[model samples]
Target: MIAEPEPGTTAEPEPEPDPEPGTVRPGGRTARVRTAVLRVAGDVLAEQGFAQLDLADVARRAGVGKTTVYRRWGSVTGLVADLLGDMAEQSLPRTETGSVLGDLRANAALVCRTLADPRQGALFRAVIAAAACDARTAEALRRFYEVRVAEWAPCVEQGVARGELPVGTDAGEVVRAVSAPLYYALLTSGVAPDAAAGERAAAAAVAAARGGVFVG
Candidate 1:
C-alpha cells in the first residue's frame, strides 16, 4: 500500500514536458504543443510578417493556452528563436554527388527552390526584416545559417579530400558562396531564382573554389 501525504503537505505535480527545440525541453505533450505553436507562428510570419506575431494570437491559432505560450517562450523573440532552431533541425541533409561541382549544383538548386517557394520565401523575408532591428532575432537568424552551413560544409571538405577542390579551401565559405547570390537576388530584386540561376551560382562557386579564392 502507498503511504498518504502528511497533514498540511502537498503532493508534487507532474513535471512539464520538454520543448521541441532551442532551450525548451521535449516530450509527448510538449512536442505536440511546440508543433502547433510553431506552425501558427510560421503562418503568421509568412502571412503578415513579424509585426503581426503575438503570443496570444499564436496560442489561439495553435489551440494552446496563452499562459502556456507566455510562460514557455517568454517573448516573441524567444518564439522566433525556437522556431528557427526547429527549422534547422528539420532542414534536409546535404547531398553527396561524388564531384564538388555536382554537389554544389545540388546545394544551389536546393537554395533556389527554397527561395522560390512563396510561403518559405515570405517567411524568410519576415525573419530577415525582424533581424534588421531586433538583436535577438538577428542572433537567431545567424545561428540558423550556422547550423545549415555546418550541415553542408562536409561536402566541400570531401571534395578537397578527393582533390576536386583546392587544398585548404574554406568549406563553410564555399558552401555559403553557392547560396549567397541566390539569396542576394531574391532580397535585392524580389526575383525568385530559377534553375538556371542555381546552375550559374554553383558554377561560379566551383570556379572560385578551383581558383583558390576560398582557400584560407
Candidate 2:
C-alpha cells in the first residue's frame, strides 16, 4: 500500500529523460519472458504494493536473469507502464446492447466486477497509490483510462446517432461519468461497488446525458 509522505520527507526526483521502454512486442522466448515478468510484477503490486516491487526480486520470482529484467524494463516505472499497457490490451471488449442505457449498464457492470475482484481490486488500489507519487505511473494510468474510455465512447455516439441522446454529447465524458462513482466509492470507502451501485451509476449517467449534461 502507498503510505503518505511523512512530514519533511521529500518526494523522489524525476529520472533523467530516456526512451520509453517495454513497448516492444516480441515473439518466441522473448514473449514468454515478458509474460512471466509481468505476471510476477503484478503479483508483487497486488500482494506487497509498489514499495516492494524490485526488479531483482521480480527477476528471481519469474526465474529470469536480473540482467534481462533490468535491460528490458530498466526501472520499476517502466515495468509498471508495460504491465498496465498489457492489461488494457487484454481487457474485454465493450458489449453492444442495442441501446445507450443498456451499453452503459454493461460498461458499469464490467467496471464493478473488475473493481470488486480480490486481486484486481488490490492491484488497482496499489497502482492508484503509486500513481500519486510517480509521474510515469500517473501517465500510464491516464493512458490506460483513455484506452478504456475510447473503447466504450462509441456507445454514446451510437446513442446520439439513434436520437436517444442530444446532439453534440461528449461521448468520452459520458463513458467516464458511468464509472466515476464506482471508483469514488472504492477509493474513499475501501469498499467494492456492488451490482446495485453499478445499476445506480448507469442510470444516473444516462439521466444526465439525456438532460444534455454531457453536451458541449
Pairing residues by index, what is the TM-score of model 2?
0.88
Give the TM-score (vs. native) of candidate 1: 0.89
Q: For candidate 2, write residues 38-156 as lDDT tens digits.
A: 99999999999999999988988887767677887999999999999999999999999999999999999999999989889999999999999999999999999999999999999
Clashing pairs in 1: 18-25, 18-26, 19-24, 19-25, 19-26
- lDDT, candidates in the order shown: 0.89, 0.91
Error of 1 at 80 (Å): 0.5
Q: Per-residue lDDT for 145 in model 2? A: 95
After superposition, the stretches of candidate 2 with alpha carbons farther than 4 Å from their true spots are 1-27
Candidate 1 clash figure, as a count: 5
Write down the worst ten-residue block by lDDT for model 1. Answer: 11-20
Q: 7 in model 1: Cα distance from truth in Å? A: 33
Scored against the true structure, residue 180 in model 1 reaches a CA lDDT of 92
| Residue-level lDDT for 180 in candidate 2 | 97
Worst 10 residues of 2 by lDDT: 11-20
161-183 per-residue lDDT for model 1 (tens digits): 99988999999999999999998
